[model samples]
Target: MCGVDQLRVGLVGGGPWARNVHGPGLAAHPATEITAVWTRRPEVAGELAAEFGGRACDRLDDLLDDVDVVAFAVPPQVQGPLAVRAAAAGRHLICEKPLAGSVEDARAVVTAVQRAGVHSSMVLTLRHSPAVREWLAGLPSAPAGPDTVASARWLSGALLGGPYSASSWRIEHGALLDLSPHVIDLLEAAVGPVASVGWAHHDEPDLWRYGLVHEGGARSTVTMSMRLPIDPTETEFAVFGPGTPHRLAGRTADASTCYAALLDELVAAVAGTGPTPALGVERGLRLQELIEQVRATAG
Candidate 1:
């Protein structure tokens, strides 16, 4: 890797997300190449390989043998075990989030990455959105003088009917597990760590809410759903404290743009000059722990 000019990447999973975002993003990056692709369906892998300028491989090991890193767009359950195998084979990782469906599975991914001493990143794309970044940076150190109350409301019709309608995991888990992590991670970043879940609730028809007590005494509320039927309002994060409220607008770019930035981070991390920060596997595990806490409290 010392004198390598391009990082060869093995892309796993050929779902809509892989085809739309991961494939396009990796293909667009100049510092890396999608050198191989392997999926549960060989035809799908072959299609993506042809479209993205990579070779299709019949086996994971064959793909592994041809690349320096592996980027996964598989479901949470599949992503977990495969990630472990990839890390064990000494491949760097670009994993999608809610790293695994269960805490135990998520922990295994963390251990594998650590033992392999590989650079890894989780696709927490919101952290790379320019609009989101501007808002985060504009906030003061104590963000509204130590008495901040933040709230995020993300309403969507993804489960009701959209590109994600076919996602079985999202259908089974619903909004809490699938969508809450995105909102929670952003809220936690803007405020502080979620020290405790004061209250959490999910009613029928896709309404979910949480009262999160952040460290340093700041409090935050999160509400999200994939069943909202109306034309959704802009996803907003608002904070109110000693002064006028401050709000951060959601991303303006498409998903591919967001993922491209994430890929850039992965490239830099592999190059040994970038810090993975909140996008790393450990942060992903912590998010999984938070998800379990919210679930336990909601139940």
Candidate 2:
């Protein structure tokens, strides 16, 4: 457990997301502090630690010793083993989407966290946005039926020419791995659990389109691409039902703001003052399973 007033955080990864959102958000949040930093690149870790008020640790073990929890912004493959080690060390976890590169790895992390009895949360940033939360809250609480349907599209040029463009994992995996988790998660949260991927397709230039059947008989279709030429990225989510359609258009709050909200939940969980995070590691594992199903269907 963390200190009653503040949670000491060990941040893994010094990439753009880590530098811009995780590190800054933790430093700015009243209930948390970036107590230690570790990354594959020592200099990058040192830079982040210098800017975020944490010590640059040469090893992950050293960082774990200094912090009450671990927040990961690393790639999924790298994050998996490190998260397992951190959970084994009895620290709480704040993990990135998909939990890990593979479903098996994600499940391992889940098992480790459960064995340690540590709290865990996934970075489903949109769910933490006030606007997105309001939109979700307005939707009908009852399980969706066949008449309920949703459509979402997230088209971006993230892998074309941006800070994320250089990401090897994003390039290799495309938007299905990078963006589908958020879309699928939101759809399920708004409607019902995804029972299966009805159909899926992946075209050149990273376009992905898929249909899903929700367990409650509702359905959702998703279109995504990170290599599009579109400027300002187009994103929208709309659900249609018997009464009226609800929509959450464009981006929600900035990553920093959403991350702050996530921090609030994590802090509360760590202090035993709140329920376990709704978007936790087990949730990540489930998303991974759904994503894998989509991939298989696409092929």
Candidate 3:
């Protein structure tokens, strides 16, 4: 039985990410308990709930009714409307990136959360990694100006053959929707808010290259793809300024570790013991807007 102080979490997916990260993270966190689980596939949900010592819910509403918060590990399109419903029901939210498939849907989610006065947090996983925190901490704090510029590249063979390759939404949308949120969010945090998409390009096999102009005149270039022939994904972020360049390379931490950190902060915010997380639904909406701009520019 969960303690009175533990936040009851309803997990809303049955896929690998949910099974591997969300279930394990919530069950392990002292401040949270996986009280209910729901997914399109009831059998899979049952399996997950059984593994985590939670009950599988046959309907979304049943899950919502049984828990204080909703943790989503589903695709962005599936997540948006459901998130709005969860917010309307007065449950706090832990949302996935991109928020929704389109800017309109993402905005709807933001509006719903605002209207309901519910606390929400985005699953910007990299932002929670200790190495990423240290990297951002070492960068210049002042708003970046013309003298500062940054670059990022995330190349992976994920779509070539893997569990994620089976994800229809990821295959359709490619790296821009699946990966740019993490990169853009990190760059924006390291420098300043992105003011405009200077240019954008996409090619066959999921390659994306884009330029962004940040507020205060700083600029950034990004290159991403999920069909590359690389073994381990190649990721690097660097800022070149007045002094020596600062760089963050390779993986920071496993997904579960970062997610646990996210849960720690989110549970605190929901309990009124901590400030609202900076990476919330509003931030997700902003990132979605930027992604749309990139797509439009590419066309």
TM-score, prediction 2: 0.98
TM per candidate: 0.95, 0.98, 0.98
Model 2 spans > 4 angstroms off: 1-4
Query: For every model in order, what is the number of clashing pairs?
Result: 0, 0, 0
Give the worst 10-residue stretch by lDDT in candidate 3: 1-10
What overall lDDT goes with each candidate model? 0.84, 0.92, 0.92
Model 3 scores a C-alpha lDDT of 0.92
Candidate RMSDs in Å, in order, are: 1.9, 1.1, 1.1
| Superposition-based RMSD of candidate 1 using all C-alpha atoms, in angstroms | 1.9
CA lDDT, candidate 2, residue 246: 93
List candidate 3 segments past 4 Å from native. none
For model 1, how does the per-residue alpha-carbon lDDT over 178-281 read when each residue is reduced to its tens digit?
77778888888788888889998988777888898887789998888887884553577888776667887654446777887887787777777877544788
Error of 2 at 265 (Å): 0.7
Residue-wise C-alpha lDDT for candidate 3, range 1-299, written one tens digit per residue: 24878988999998888888888889999989999999999999999999986799999999999988999999999999999999999999999887997899999999999999988989999999999999888888846999999999999999999889999999999999999999999999988999999999999889999999999789999999999999899999999998789999998867988998898888888888998888999999999999999999999
In model 2, the worst 10-residue window by lDDT is 1-10
